[model samples]
Target: MIAGHGPLRRLKDGTAELHQEAELHVRILDADATLTDYRRYLAAMFGYHAPLEDALAGHEGLRRAGFDPARRRKSPLLVADLRALGEDPGALPPCVAVPPVTTLPRALGVAYVLEGATLGGRYILAKLPPQLAPLRGRATAFLAGYGAQTGACWRAFAAVVERVLVTPEAEAEAVAGARETFARLIDWLAAQTRAAGAALREAS
Candidate 1:
């Protein structure tokens, strides 16, 4: 199953155990990608790889602790294809912010960075459920943050995700850290979202 369109979900049942472990191994493989091209692809979609690997490791740790999320099988062909694409000399730039930039080239950059991927890779790894669904604070944060700082929306988005998914006791810390890291951008995005709302009402 698809996890709200961002990544593939693991299948449960007889396939769960093996498939779950397979994804972990694949994740580790990507985490250790030796190619510069792969690293660049990672940077484009996600802000950085180290944090992403951390997040993935966290989830794997959770699973080891007996969390029962669905399992996803790895495809060798898919991995080879990704490896090949990463190695391609003419591969596109990873990702670009949308709406704020809105340039055709930049928009295309976003698409290229996200294209042909079944999973969020590092991007979704740093995320919580709300970022991908239920339209939480992250969306609010993104429009509020924008260009003032790069990847602010993503950071707030990830934080809000952690808040909702993590226990309430930890929510404030998560939000605060996210706010600190992506401060300028998240503030701008929030402002933009508000402005857009006002514009929509004026048009109406």
Candidate 2:
């Protein structure tokens, strides 16, 4: 347990279970996962991130808290990877069931899940199947987010989270938002009727 009454600690500890569950539900690293599965993963991710980031953009709290959301965007990376794989990202449907980041606390919580993925991107990149070797640089951009700067980026985000979510109410909102992001993302990826439908469902 991260022993602290601080909102960041609470948010991290509170979402630990859901975090693990989300990992289990995410299939990009599965041993048998193939190139098609990778394409679907990006598509599903694009579906989720496209809408979520749109919600976070221009939020005053992010600027006040010293967080730069533009630098943290993953949707573009997903699009580039998809295009490299010979898919038209614009043709894919974006997820509409995205969590609402209506407030600073909620936005922070939602961003927590999205920003955290950069850290795991290294692991995901390393575990990518040999089949992806042909599309190496192009297909792996999303997973190679921030590359060597991932650690610094996470620390900066942590600072913003801890600085902004100082009150109990803010903590509650942030935690709830984080948990919802985790749950909804899993649902968005797992639901068989969305952009990634068949491949993501198979991945799950």
Candidate 3:
């Protein structure tokens, strides 16, 4: 239903349900969320993104597909935000493992999820409470990564994805990869939420 090139259209349609489920689990729209909640959210994000970015680093297929790993990496930004929030990055729990993205199409699929989140990040940043407003671009670097250029960056990545996923088989692979990424991310965030709740109970 999403109007776009073949691969992107397939990705949007195939992963729509999974994407909605993941967003619900992440609870980005919870207006009553506090600074502590935001910290936990960043931690969850770091855990999800670190491993995936590591796998995509220096990937030959991504480079050949015209995707730039440097411009797209957000794991470091998550770590920085955690540190800025006075949480030690090394003290956070390990990130969940992502499925292997061995081919260009698969990488593009994963990239689609990661890059698409940044679009929504702008809205998330805007919704932060006044007490947490100062952390916008610093402690929330991952969300505000591109600052004003976020839309342009997404458009550029879309162009590359459309170019790389040319064949029918490639488009299918991209959709499969995006669906798998969304599923794993939902599981990981749910686990993190449970862990945080348990910790809160113990402290009280």
Candidate 4:
């Protein structure tokens, strides 16, 4: 896991490019000032780089497969495209088409552990540890709300992923897990949007 400013640099190469793209949404969450400061506090307490290099290298591999790093630079939403399994950013594996909100947070929370492993190797060893569950829970809540908000504005999210991350490849297990999490959140938001639309129709 290479850490630094900007999108997954590892996608520049072929091997990890797709996986790199799929995880782009997490980048947006990381960029939030509040979240960044919070993560920094934890990372610092344990000694962490603002940006890790290994993860970036992994992202570069994905870029080589078809992800456009330049697009990711435009905005965080563009980073979402990197998560698609194929050219169609909207397409998703059956396993991830419907994600439960309850399970979403735990999955989203796993990102820190995954990122740490990718970046530090034995340097970091494991996750934030069970002791940090409070922080992790907070992150999960933030992610849930953020996803709902983002999904309500999904065209933007889709645009970002389609432009930069969509590629012709199998949605690997890791990619599948991320997609499942994202799909669940987006689907839930889409439902809420539709319900709101229905209420507006009744008033009209």
Winner by lDDT: 2
Top-down lDDT ranking: 2, 3, 4, 1
lDDT values, one for every candidate: 0.30, 0.82, 0.81, 0.31
**Clash count for each candidate, listed in order shown:** 19, 0, 0, 39
Candidate 1 residue lDDT tens string, 81-186: 3444443323522212222212222222121222212333433333433323332232222212222333442333223233233443333333333322233223
The whole-model C-alpha lDDT of candidate 1 against the native structure comes to 0.30
Q: Write the per-residue lDDT of candidate 2 for residues 1-204, one digit (tens) a residue.
A: 122657767888989999888787667677677787788788888989998888887677787789878767889899999998899999988889999878988999999889877877777787776666566677888889888888888888888888888888999999999999999988977773354565567899
Give candidate 1 misplaced runs (Cα > 4 Å). 1-43, 55-61, 64-82, 86-168, 177-204
Better of 1 and 2 by TM-score: 2
Candidate 2 displacement at residue 67 in angstroms: 1.3
Q: Candidates 2 and 4: which is better by TM-score?
A: 2
Candidate 4 TM-score to native: 0.24
lDDT by residue (26-140, candidate 3, tens digit) is: 6544766678878888898888787788788758778766778766888888888888888898877766567677888888888889988888788778877676777776788
Clashing pairs in 2: none
Each model's Cα RMSD: 19.7, 3.5, 2.1, 18.4
TM-score of 3: 0.91
Query: What does candidate 2 score on TM?
Result: 0.88
Model 3 misplaced regions, further than 4 Å: 1-5, 129-131
Once fitted onto the true fold, the runs of candidate 4 whose alpha carbons sit more than 4 angstroms away are 1-171
